[model samples]
Target chain A: MALRFALLAALYEEPLTGYDLTLKFKTRLANVWNASHQQIYKELGKLHEEGLVSVEDIPQQGKPDKRLYRINETGEAALSDWVNTAHNRPPTRDPLLVKLFAGGLLDRDKLAHELADTRQIWREQLAYYRSVEAQYFTSRAEMPAHFRFQHLALRRGILGMESNLQWLGEVEAMLADLAAGV
Target chain B: MALRFALLAALYEEPLTGYDLTLKFKTRLANVWNASHQQIYKELGKLHEEGLVSVEDIPQQGKPDKRLYRINETGEAALSDWVNTAHNRPPTRDPLLVKLFAGGLLDRDKLAHELADTRQIWREQLAYYRSVEAQYFTSRAEMPAHFRFQHLALRRGILGMESNLQWLGEVEAMLADLAAGV
Candidate 1:
């Protein structure tokens, strides 16, 4: 549902093929949202059927003809309405907490190990966010003004991962204390 | 799947009723994960049927009998294995980016409003994290040694929320700039 409107908004800027939108999503909005190629293609069809977007075919010599999508006026109106009026809280469900709460039943050693593994995962994620930040911020002035908002999202990702890592360390320490009967 | 193991591990500490598990989750592992009463009951039943968790009835005078759940040895082993194993990368999906990408198709004013609304949501989340941190840190010394790990998770939540709020500010600024055509 949100994807439909987002796609329309992107098209409003310039006509793009489904493939182009996917790439844009990875670079520009990678921190906030993601979608599989299959999902993107599916939404494109829905947007066209609803007349929110129009499809154009460009003839090509050897390669497959590209199906370009542009937001129609109606599509623009819909995207605007959604932006202004739509509910803003994104849906979130995390399975890790569920496991942790239930951790009491497992051996203390086992829980400790899981916490360690979770910590490592967060470390990797933190590194990735930092690398991406460096890539974007190196030429900050050359980037689009709107990119500042995306950068903020990236910062959140980094902090979130770092916090998890910190939490994992605490968990590990606690487990060790419990094992030693301290 | 993670829920089952979390619950099993938690039971390893001490037998708990479903309600107790829910409260512990909120206080102990709230940063890493979250679950509702409905999910708790559902998972409990599944665990019981699978012979992973055993339920003992505690008679109460006025209230219903407390069904205390304990992890069986088999469940313990499973939880242990899970903790030691590698976890798959978290699946990524965000609706906000999609809307931003599609912004060109929508009404400019409407898009601006949406960005504003998103900023407000992030602010609220940041406030919540701060409150949680304040409450936890106030009695830091009294916390169990293992709680050190839990504190790290709490910090992560705090930082993550702060970063999100910061991002929203940048986004809001960009939307304003776009509105002003500057």
Candidate 2:
């Protein structure tokens, strides 16, 4: 899975058990790549067999044995090799885009309602991004070394929602004109 | 293929041979939902099998028989059903975002170079979207009744690119700060 590389990158920071990896993947990597715990467990097994990661067995008192995975030199090299190259924007498979493109099929009233609903959704998303920024952008001294990178991802999310909200306004105006036969 | 629904929507415009569908898909749907001619042809076959579309075999003089496909009533109902509901934003799988999240993995110079390259790419893309707008937004009267819908999709592309360009600016400045040990 493409998530393997992301998991490798996470482990590069420090050794973490499967649960920690899943949590990190949720908060830290949630904006870029999202993976389920089941998927992460599966990839950890593969990384172990591939020798890209080393597992540490930590015996816990009265608890199940904890297995932590760390990225080895091989995994570090692999991640760097993958990161050195340029990456392109992915092709559009967005269902909203598809629906908008097929808008002629919908009744004008129905279409307007759809656009209005989407606008509300984007507005809520913008607020969510702001909340995220507020929580994380407390101070630079407390910032992690990778904070800039992670912050960029959050900023991207904010910018995207802002732009979408603007377009939705324009769309609503256009819908008004269409409904009025303007 | 999900592309089949897109194809069905395209056919909803009017009956067209596979060739016409490809051209329209490229020019009109390229930004929102891109599909190659080969994929379109494959979907058309599936659509026919599912009774979503009806094909007309047109006789040609000393050449291959032209096949035209049109969306049947079932297809129209399905398309409407699909379009009326809300569509969730697609999950992010961007490699650049992934890279940014793992910024400590790269040398500062290398990361700066990658960001610069992406900035250049997005700049070029902004120009491309402008060209596409000039081509389509010439005269509203010439547009189909669905023109408003199609036009909204194009505007969405322009806005997204603009937002990305702005975010890239912030990122490049941040990279410079990091490089200078700020």
Candidate 3:
């Protein structure tokens, strides 16, 4: 739903094709929400049917005709109304945590392997966050004011990854102690 | 699905009632997974119907009957299979980030207020992580071997929270800069 609102908001700024919205979502909104190409296409059709967005057909010489979307007045009103309202708390369901909670039922070796694997995955995430941080700090000056808001979200992502990396290190130490019964 | 496995894993150690599972989940597996009573009850019923768990009723004179659950051989096999196989990547979605992405559509002051609120929330989360960290470290000597695995997960939670806090700080700074148009 937030993704829909974001797409509408972007189109409100200026008419954009589905492909354009996808790119914008990645660079500007990837930290907050993600939408696959299929989802984007589906939502565009839904929004058009709902009269919240209007589609314009742009001729392309050899390729498929681009469907440019612009927010309708109804869409603008809906967006405005949504912006004023507080969103509900995000729902969460994590499978890995469940596995950990029941770890006592498994052999120590198997549990250790899972934790080690998780730590490695988080390490990779930390590296990705650092890369994102570097990318933003180096190139953020050229972005628009609204985009700067998106950058704030990216900063959060980077920090979140860093925290996970640090925690993973401490956990490794504890796991080693357990393995040795120390 | 993971929750079911977690419960089965817990029952694999020894039969436990739903209440006991909740308490154990909060402390031992809080980092890895979380489940409400409603969810646990629902899943327990499903597991029973599937013949993956057996529940024995322990009558209490004045209190509710204790429904102690133990994992059946089938359940154990399921858990073993899950551990050996590769799992899908963890899902990641943050609505706050989505809001920030479409922030240009919102009034500037409104966006700033949301950012401030988000920062405060992360600060509270960091404090909670700190408390958890302190508890884990203080009890390190007396904790069980399996607990060491759980502690590793707890550390991950702490680091994830800390990283979010740090990101909040950077975001606050960026918002301030944007407000100042610098």
Candidate 4:
């Protein structure tokens, strides 16, 4: 359901081919949502059938034509309706949390190793998000309205990763102390 | 897949009927994962057929007998193997972020209202998590090993909610200032 709206939101920014939308998900939108190229193409087909989006084909000189998608007024209204309505935060199903919940039954060293690996992954993500912030959002307050709001979503990702890293650090220290009989 | 391990982890503590496992998901396990009752029952059936778990029917008075599930040695080994393997953090799909990303195209007051509602929800959740922490984790060092690990998962939930609430506050303030033409 959210994926439908995510695709609509991406098209709201500008006219894009299905390929361009997939790239947006891989880069800018990676912080918020993820969708495979197949999912993006499938959803675009549904949006077209539902009359929420219209597609135009541009003939290429030496290649297959490109289908560009633009959100119709109905699609903009749908995005507005979804934005105005309040939704409960969806429950997250984390494999690491589940493992930690059952951590007592597992080896401490193995669990700590898992935590370390996860922390490293998050660290790289944080670095990437920071680089984006520095490059594109250095002056968020003065940015055009659309980019301002986009920055908010990216900022949330940065804070979320930071909070996760902090928790991982605390847990790693606790595991160390436990190993030392502290 | 994670759900199967979560159920197995619960049974590792002790055998439980499907009904009892569902209750755990509703309360203590809610922080870690959410599963529909039908999903839980269905997964339990699969685990039984796969020889990962053994089930026994305990007689009851006047009602249908209860089906109790116990993790087998095979189940324990499966859980151990899963725990030892590190997995990349799964991508999160958040409706709030989607709305915020497209927010510039929407009305400001409505977006702010949505933020406030989401903040209220997180505030209540934070309070609930804190209460659980106070009640169950008052003496972390003195707790049995199992409970210490459980506390770590809950603590992560608390931190994550706090981070979310902080982001919500900042966004709301920005929206307010924009409305004021500041």
Q: Write the per-residue lDDT of candidate 2 for residues B105-167, one digit (tens) a residue.
A: 767677777777877877776787788788877775646657767778889888988999999
Candidate 1 similarity to native, TM-score? 0.68
Q: Write the per-residue lDDT of candidate 4 for residues B1-182, one digit (tens) a residue.
A: 78899898888889998999999887778778888889999999999999999999999999889999999999999988887777777787888889889977677877777777777878888898999999989973577777888889999989999999888877877777677777
Instruction: Tell me the DockQ of each model, to 2 decimals.
Output: 0.30, 0.63, 0.46, 0.70
The residue ranges of model 1 lying beyond 4 angstroms of the native Cα positions read A57-65, A86-88, A91-182, B9-14, B19-28, B57-66, B96-145, B168-182
Residue A18, model 3: Cα distance from true site in angstroms: 3.9
Name the top DockQ candidate. 4
In candidate 4, position A120 carries an lDDT of 84
For candidate 3, what is the DockQ-based docking class?
acceptable
Best by TM-score: 4
**Which model scores highest in lDDT?**
4
Question: Better model by lDDT, 2 or 3?
Answer: 2
DockQ of 1: 0.30
Q: Residue A137 error for model 1, in Å?
A: 7.4
TM score of chain A per candidate: 0.74, 0.76, 0.73, 0.90
Q: Residues A38-126, candidate 3, lDDT per residue (tens digit)?
A: 88889999999999999999999999999999998899888877775666445445565555544555455665676678778767765
Each prediction's total of clashing residue pairs, residues at least 3 apart in sequence or on different chains, is 40, 0, 4, 0
| Order of quality (lDDT) | 4, 2, 3, 1
Per-candidate Cα lDDT values, in order, are: 0.67, 0.80, 0.71, 0.87
The collision pairs in model 4 are none
Q: Quote the positional error of residue A101 for candidate 3 in Å.
A: 2.9
Q: What is the interface RMSD of candidate 1, in Å?
A: 4.5
Model 4: CA > 4 A from native:
A59-64, B61-64
